[model samples]
Target: MGIAEEQSKASAALASSKTTSSSRDSASTAPAQRQAGKIDVLIQGVALFSDGYNIQIIGYMNTVLAKLYPKQMTTQVKTRLSNSILIGDIFGMLLFGLCIDRFGRRVGIILTTLFLVFGIILATASHGATVEGMFWMMVTGRGVAGVGAGGEYTVCTSQALECADSTPEMRRRRGMLVAVSTNAAIISGFVGSSIVSLIVIAAYGGKPSDGIWRICFGIGIILPLAIFFFRMRLNDSEQYRKHAIHSKMPYWLAIKFYWRPLLGCCSAWFLYDFVVYPFNLLAPTLVSGFSKDQSMISSIGWSALVNFFALPGSFIGALLMDRIGRRQTYALGWSIVCDFGFAIGGSMIQLKNIFPLFVVLYALFQTFLSVGPGDCNFLVSSESFPTPLRGHFLGFAAAIGKVGAAIGTTTLSEALASFDNPTKGQQAIFLIGSAISVVGTLCVWFLIPDAPVNLEDEDVRFRNYLEANGYDTKEMGLSASNT
Candidate 1:
């Protein structure tokens, strides 16, 4: 055969292979549609709780660590902590994605929990080391723990969304799991900060402290234990079976083909974290500017007490998401975030009395920004990709998000140093974050396209994407949506 004929034959073979796979997938999904049932809320709740717990641990680690070694900890050192954790987080994200695909969610969760336990204990023990050695050891432990956090968010979101019945009504129910994770995250920050404060006060008698942070580190092991036991009853989503039979594509190829959706998802997540990390960490550092002692107490107080309000904020955000649609919900949340940036700036300028009004406005702004974007970001992430690639996509977004987080933490330190007052620096960071949130919202509104709200739609989109690219998908007839 001539070169053109050979090329044509190769193309035909690839097309035939794709069609055959599509038909088989369609056949496999029929059973899933026939037996649509609600996923157990208790199981998903445990997964979400664990996910929130890990984020809490990470969210507070740098602040708590800096407190422990006040004389030795510089802005540069703190930035390293942030960057190191992100590095570890990326590895964990990738590892979780691969494990979930190959070994299933239960196995993946179980394996990662083991890592969390080990990492936390090791980090806590680092407190005993000399300052120079301890910093590096603590960084290592956090990195490992971050990996566990990455897994929890990525795998749990995918698993929760997958197990829901795929009917339209059921799809809405599944989407609530995203809210569960977000609600838990906001609450955990409150809880973790409180826990850290109580431990510090009791151990150190309200003085400049270090040892109490070790207790904070050790406490990280508890949720993973609880989650592992609870997740024992959980099972893999029905969609995986369809993918196995229909796509006939190796899991890796399926993921590679869906990279576009993954890119959009990751970009959104990166921007979300860029704003969130600086905002969250600002509480402790900004407060520290007033007095070292007051800073710790104030951060602890806000984290514990203020977080009570975040649950309601998240619920409201979720309700709006269900009502207003994902794009509008995200746009509204980001707009609020942007508005708060100006509020923060104005409040800072009015600091003649260091007004109670400024403090109250800042806290409230943190609340809306915390709950709203968090709710929208996780929800969009959960729904953006199909079950087969969901975990990988989540992981990819998480890995990239960590980079944004590092930028947040690192820039926060610089902003603080450049301005004489830490509070002023914080106002600057908030202003910048607010601007980013606005841009992020616009990106979602104009550029980020919508996806199928049900499994049938998801299947059609997947099949269509392949077919348009000259791949046949006649074999996998499966397109059942898990309601």
Candidate 2:
């Protein structure tokens, strides 16, 4: 061969050898990397399980508070008590959402646990100069806890999504893992709250006593601390490491590209939570209206059982997410809920006469709640955007959803107080929720865009989109330590 041709062939051969060696290195690490991703997601999800348990258990605790401090647990006090974390959700979601995007997932995740620990410890040890003062102290403590809980929605889901994107095998099931695995924990939290309250109340011989209230609040501290340690062991997700913005983001440029999907995500979450949280908060109340002879404890057990039905629904949603995609699956779930809700709400009078049947139908309605919006909100919020902006959009959507939860809870409480018959009030909740679901369905069709499941894929599109709009993509990426 000629001298020039010989030099070119030698250079190409050396480059190919280096590429093969790199592939070998990546192949060797892939399994461990995948396993670490699973561990990371599991740890984050456990905190959510605790969150579900901690937050929902309060409904049962509220019953105890009313009995123990008749003069203290006023309607207004109860409202604040129920909404404390929900109100906290707004601030937590907003602040932590921004922080996670700006700082890093590790920083946001670790800091959040401290808030939870403080909130839980302060709440469990709630004390003041007087009984009335103590109750407000409890409210403040829970509000703090709510902030932690609110932040969890943003950080946990974002972290979990990135973790699921760690490998192709994992990425294919990302919908099921991110949506069902973590969300099921939240739903299970609802179940755990009900069941644990039932067990604790049973320990107290079917009573909502001082001890019952304290124990329930105390149990919330465990997971936050456990996960705090787990979180310390974690590095930022590889995806976050790869594409996270190292400098100030161009907000105007981001909006130019993402605004449409952002609107859909925020609106869907708001409507879904508005429809769902009220029914969840008032489960015992609804059960009591139907089962006139049951005691408060019996109603709590039934609520647990009712919430259990959502677990299956969440799994079904996960499957649907993969098969049909996010927008379609969410729409189908909402449509089913709307139909069943209208039927159940309209038939309340007749169904009350057949209470067992009513319970089944009520649970079935709750099932679809998880199947559709419960699954969709987190998946859509976390997935539609790239890693750098995932926290922002997810947090914004969650914060808006919490506002809906707060308003829905308050409005339903008003409906219950306004109506002469309690059944009428529940009927109103079902019907109104169904109508809201219809609006939610429309948002999905018109606004919500379908997104790729893989983090790398979405990041590419986002980077390219930004470049098209005169923004730089080179400034984003991991440092050598991050890689």
Instruction: Please give, for residues 1-483, the per-residue lDDT of candidate 2 as tens digits.
Output: 343353344344543444543443454322233345677776777878988887787787877787788887777787788888889879999989999987888788777887888998888999999988898889899989888888988888988888888888888888888886577879988888888788888999986678898898998887787668767777777677666786778787677567888999989999988878878877877787775678668888777777789888988898888888888888888889888889998998888789888889888888988988889889888899888898888899889989999998888777776788888887888888889988988998788888675666566666655554567655566552234
Native-to-model Cα distance after best TM-score fit, residue 351 in candidate 1, in Å: 3.5
- lDDT by residue (tens digit), candidate 1, 46-144: 555544544555445556666666777877777776666566667888889767865567777787777777777777788435797888888888788
Instruction: Tell me the whole-model lDDT of each prediction, alpha carbons only.
Output: 0.63, 0.80
Q: For model 1, give the 10-residue run with minimal summed lDDT.
A: 474-483
Error of 2 at 277 (Å): 1.0
Local error of candidate 1 at 354, Å?
A: 4.0
Report the error of model 2 at residue 273, Å: 0.9
TM-score of each: 0.82, 0.90
